[model samples]
Target chain A: MSRSARSFAVAGAVLLAFTGLASADAVKLGRPALPEEIKAWDIDVRPDGLGLPEGQGSVSQGEELFQNNCAACHGEFGEGVGRWPVLAGGQGTLTSERPEKTIGSFWPDTSTVFDYVHRAMPFGAAQTLQPDEVYAIVAYLLYLNDVVPDDYVLTKENFPTVALPNRPNFYDDDRETTEKAFWKATPCMKDCKPKVEITSHAAVLDVTPDAGKEGDKPAGAVE
Target chain B: MNQMKPGSRVDRRRFLTLAGLAGACAAVGVQPAAAEATPDPDIVNLPPWTQALGAGVNNHPYGVPSPFEKDVVRREVTWLTASSESSVSFTPLYALDGIITPNGLCFVRHHGGEAEIDPTRHRFMIHGLVDKPLVFTMEDIKRMPGRTNRVYFLECAANSGMEWRGAQLNGCQYTHGMIHNVVYTGVPLRAFLEAAGVKPKGKWVLAEGADASAMTRSIPLEKAMDDCLVAWAMNGEALRPEQGYPLRLVVPGWEGNMWIKWLRRIEVGDQPWGQREETSKYTDLLADGRSRRFTFIMDAKSVVTSPSPQAPLHARGPNVISGVAWSGRGTVTRVDVTLDGGKNWTTARIEGPALPRSMTRFYLDVDWNGEELLLQSRAMDDTGYVQPTKAELRAVRGVNSIYHNNGIQTWLVRSNGEAENVEVS
Candidate 1:
């Protein structure tokens, strides 16, 4: 068949389907996602504690797990490795020149610790452990932050009870006060600010069109 | 090219910035790790200027930006807000290239907190106004045939949130670093919604993340059908943990909050959910004291990365001033570079291929006379919108808020070739 004829035929079928059979036939096309399949990948632990898993672990178990899995990057005490995020030491430093913002000091919720650990911790190897391991890791994180007792065990059952240290520090902004102060009028029309004038120009690179310039020497060659 | 006499201050600063190269000269014995197009630096072995190795084996399933790129990372000032956690961090949009922002270098902002989730037993349930009320597993979703798109860019409404008041930060990394672009692979939301069977009246959807806070947002169903994606991979790999590994919602050209990470569930609804993220946060304020609720799209914006405050002007002669520009409304058409503040604008040579909703590189070839000059860039999108200046933005949005500031940025280049963030009135 000619290309235009094929296109016409396909268009007719699409129009027919859209007008009559589109809604009815659409239901049968895709299969229902299985529960087990869902369970295998549904790892979220919501702020309202809707998806907490069934296993449990104590602070001691958590500490052991953290040391085994998280300490290298987060720091042994969650001080955070190098530029890695500091998790434990930023207690009450929110107002200082440099705030610490550790889990104990800055995090607004206890569940975030649990959620982050179970989903993405131990960096290179994700989704390798059981639910209990995640709980234990959370407990250990809490213990390190002094948010929970050393002997405390974190379980799905009591997960929501653990409160983060900086819980009350969070607030919502409607930005009403800010809008009146900014972003409300038609922007400037005339001679705005000092008119930007170009004094000189430089070519940083010559990557375009592969210009064989003298200074465009490839990196790593002997000078 | 203009030649400078010896012992000039401009030459001195260039020497200091390249002081590390002195070690490279000494370590000529150092072997290039990989022989790509460019001889790759021994990035893996060198100590990052910032991060140390994280604790435990759990340091990072996906590693972060290298230390040398530390100067290219996010920056936030305390005076920008009361608490650092509540304030914003800008991405070094000017310094990065290609579409992918390494997981470590991706900018992060949170209202409640960052959630940790284990993906092995993860689940996603679709209820509320759905015909089948189905649930999906990660394996199931992955098994289903999905599409991979090499589109780029995801930005926060508050990316330049601080620039509205003034050029508070000293670098382009801070003023315009909140945006990033990358190709992603995932199931299309339209396909997922079709499979789940939306009800006759389903008009909006609420996406929720699994982290402890369960971050949630409501998105229009039409927008979902338009181009929304449930992403599982970024730059051809599994999602970075910090970037919502396992699963996330990708709403291109929209505010970052709607692109939910650590995505947990999607509830079909006939009306907007009015969640905390949408109502209390992410909304824009107007000049008359009325808040602009549901301001979904981002405006056109650009920044000159090189010769920027943090990157600095290395020498006075010939300098290549480069940076990135993008718009959520559409593609960037042109970028104007101004050396005397915002006076006479020169059309910058837009390099690299431009893509819709992706970062476009712009370059200006200029020779410096070793005198003080104000550096600035204004981006124009395909839709014919020019990037607004700081005062223009303040006239419309007011200054009390800290979000959606897409104003033109200024860098003060001193006689010594040092650049600092400055507001030009």
Candidate 2:
């Protein structure tokens, strides 16, 4: 039995002893999951190409798809529109004041682009792209980032070979080793700090919208 | 906001000293305002509520808050996101009391946008490294073995994301509102994975949602086996449409985004998927250029809700200053309130159940002298991790990463009873 179930069983046993009435509320349920339903929903692709569906598409085909579906939110060259994520470029800019993390710059594996595009590209319309279309759009994104040649065509075989420039930049979490000091048995209480000066204010930055502006009422007024 | 009349500040001492006949007037019947206000002849007859019979039951099939509470709704800062569809609305923290956030008052955060998923057509699938690949309909899943009632706080990794740079938001609603606590009714995810029989080599489980973003995150197998749950009902009723009606993953103590809404797929895998959320968006950029990936656990945090910018004090005598304190790692054992900034700290009274990974309400009823005060709350959890200051946090993490900011927030209360968001030394 799982830990949660084991705990529940103990609680039930205790309750049964107390009442002595024998409540038969326990009922086992749920049927085995179907294979066809699994196939339809299991669309994730790992870095080792574990879940990449069989597909092939050229850069040219992906370019057309990008313009038709993606360009409205992601700019013509994958610069990003409004606050939608930027897909390409931002190479060698990780150390800059404002790092523009994009496919060519920060992402490590090629499968992320493939899996993300296949399942959730074009914003509002997700999971609409076919396996082949996903391959094409990913290939076109690579072309935009200068990761591929104009004649390049991505396939399930070649997808594993394409790696990002910033692949070596990421590392596993090291909070236990790096932030041990944060774990304190007893923190300073009285006069912990002699004086705490005022450093900044929200009004100074002017990022927050004015609080009492009744002009723009909520769309669905509960009242 | 029933402060004594202008000249009554002096009379306040007299009332305290005398315990006088005015107490009789209060004994008869009097709202606080009636204690002092000079009654007008036209209005002294009867108030609207006293004059007429109130509306009957079923006036609202599902009831709403009083019309007087119209302003107590979730609000979004216009500058936070590009569009409302792919945006977030903060919970009205200042206007709330206690730790339990009502389903309607809970905050909303979406990526590609809020989706209206029909449960009839919705299906949840578990595939990849498993002995038996499985799929479940809403009904199929609800019939599972156990329905555990667990209360956990779901805080977005970016709960106070804006503050990493500085005190950029005015209210606690905006500053620390990307969170909610609730009782979940569902089976443990390990039970379903066990039924399917996870392969020995399955090191990770990539959970995917069905929204426009199809939000996905890779949970390590150990963590998945530990506390993760596939919950359907939140706070008793069916999950709100805004909260992924049919199903959602309840990852206790982890960042909110990982608790995938409209949950549809869970694929057991041998390695981390390195999805976009873990890499591009949620990753933390260090001062030296290296970025920390998969920084999932939300650190210990707390905030003073009342006497905040939106809910300022009008009455200065005896008042209850309350707020919430929580830790992703464990239960909050103690919460300290600092009336004079960080100089002096006193342990506040913790109220309600102190459950693991759940919010605990703390309060300190104080006699406000109506002086300029710097208010702050510091929380310490079972893990012995005390909530750090904004300075200490910034010194280590720097101001680059806009996530996982569990620093102490300070609210400046002026003599005139208005509070503004501010930072301290």
lDDT of 2: 0.81
TM-score of chain B of 2: 0.91
**Model 1 per-residue lDDT tens digits across residues B204-249:** 8888787644677778899988888888888788887767878999
* Candidate 2: segments with Cα more than 4 A from true spot: A1-28, A211-223, B1-44
Write model 2 residue lDDT over B150-184, tens digit each, in one string: 99999988888877767778899999999998899
Error of 2 at B30 (Å): 17
Total clashes for model 2: 1
Evaluated with lDDT, which candidate comes out highest? 2
In angstroms, the error of model 2 at B2 is: 24
Native interface contact recovery, model 2: 0.64
Q: Each candidate: what lDDT?
A: 0.66, 0.81
